[model samples]
Target: MTKIANVRCQLVDLEPETARSDASQSFVKQETVLVTVETVDGMSGTGYSYTIGTGGTAVVAMLRDHLVDGLLGADARNVEQIWQRMVTGTRATTVGAITSLAMAAIDVALWDLRGQRADEPVWRLAGGAHDRLPLYDTEGGWIHLTCEELVRNALAAKAAGVRGVKVKVGKPSLTEDAERLAAVRDAVGPAFEIMVDANQCFTGAEAARRAHSYESLGIAWFEEPLPADDLAGHVRLAAATTVPIAVGESLYSSLRFAEYVAAGAAGIVQVDAARVGGITPWLKVAHTAESFNVPVAPHFLMELHASLACAVPNGMYVEHIPQLGAISRGGHVIEEGWIRPPESPGIGIDWDLDAIDNLRVA
Candidate 1:
């Protein structure tokens, strides 16, 4: 048997290329909790999860203090069994963010090992629904950028063959949001897609007003207009608007996704693998969204989400945020306007071990 031999976890902080923000909060940095699992025979794989700017040490603590011990000597191939064990063992925190993020690191490492053992890339190992996915730029759309900056970024992305760009909304006034969207729409023109995200900073009534105003500009969707937990409010907003209501980045479990889908509260499902626990539940959420005919445009962690977007049929677009550059070599290859997953065995990221060591804090 390929038995598990050891598990190791560490924390690394990476600065963003530029200041990032949305309606709800500012982007300070990314605190990443990385995990590596090695089998008795010496084969190994690595996986990771992240916090926007905090909680990485806690995730590492959860692994080192509460989770990693159970993984020792466990069957490396029994991914589902081991995932359940971790979930049940942390029953009190099972469906919460820190626990989910902690489990995600370990769970993803197991999937990586599974892929390496089978000599397949994770996208194919998971589902192989498609080989490539359309790319959309979100890095240029921070709420703090001026209208001219937004136009410049969108134009640059278009010139580079990117299919679309997401613009952050939720300024003090709906008029300000309208002006920003209009400037980008007028610049990018009608053919290039434009998505607007409020970052969950509006009430149901305010979101409806903005949705009506943005409809004229031809936005692809209105993302996170209301808070993630407001199921009833989202349902009301969905019914009131012609534009699709995109949600799920804040959600921590597949069950939460099911609740939203069954209630007709979500028009687009934005599952983040790290937030949902791991690739195991990430796939579950995607498939669940598919069952309801809801499409997926996962939130961030572009390096990881690229493979995941290709793994499922319902995956609509992969948001381009590019947060892995500081600790990794190479990147997603964008051909024409679409991004392709790495064909390498296992999860496929080329980690720069020296850089990781340099940044390691825990």
Candidate 2:
């Protein structure tokens, strides 16, 4: 048995590729918590989770002060067992952001180890349901961008072969939001996909109103139109609109996703691997969404999500928001608007160790 010999955690602060803002918050930086788990035989794998700008230290502390000791001598291959142990040990913090993020770092690292030992990519290990996933640009559609800017970016993405671009909705008025989306729609034409994201900015009534307004535009989906915790509101909004309600990025557990899917609140599920705990639970959420015949277009972390999206049969699109350039070499190869998962073992991220060292803050 390859017993876990060492576990290390570090914090790296990375700036966003561009100044980004939506209805909810501004992304000032990515406070990433990186974890490395090494076995007694000298094999190692890396995993990470992030916050937009805060709580990175807490995530690190959770790993160092509570999680790492439990992993030091456990069977590294028994990922599910270790994951459950961590959840049980951190019972007080289970199903919350910091604990989930901490577990995610370790859980993904274990999956990485599994991939390396099996000599297969994480995608194949997870499911290998698809070889590639279509790409959509979210970086180009911040709420702060002007209508012209949104149009230009959508055109650029389309020209680059991207299938769609997400336009952030939640201007001061509904008409303003409509105008902005209309401009992008006019520029991209009807054939290209346009997804509108409210970023959890609207009330159920407001979300329903906007959904109705945007439905004529032929958007791919209305993303996060209401707060994630408001299941009843989402159900109401989803029922009231022809536009699909896409949620799950802010949900912290598979059970929460199951609730949304079961309630018919989520027409499209957008699970984030890091936020939902790790690859283990992430797969659970994906398969759960699949059982309901719902499509999953994951949230951020494109580098990690690329492989995960390909791993699932129901994955719809991978949102494009590159944020790893400062700590990694190369990036996802976007070929004709689709991203192919890296064929290498583990999670498929090509981490730049030197870059990570330079940015390490804890």
Q: List the lowest-lDDT window of 10 residues for candidate 1.
A: 329-338
What lDDT tens digits, residue by residue, belong to model 1 across residues 1-362? 58999898989999987899998899998999999999999999899999998888888888989999999999999999999899889999878999999999998999999999999999999999999999999999999999999999999999989999999999999889899999999999999999999998998889999999988888899999998889999999999888998999999999999999999988899999999999999999999999999999998989999999899999899998988899999646888779999899888899999999999999
Error of 1 at 39 (Å): 0.5
Tens-place lDDT per residue, model 2, 21-79, is: 99999998899999999999999999999999999999999999999999988999999
CA-lDDT, candidates in order:
0.92, 0.92
TM-score per candidate, chains pooled: 0.99, 0.99
Q: What is the lDDT of residue 8 in candidate 2?
A: 86
Looking at candidate 1, what is the lDDT of residue 103?
Answer: 93
For model 2, how many clashes?
0
Backbone clashes in model 1: 0
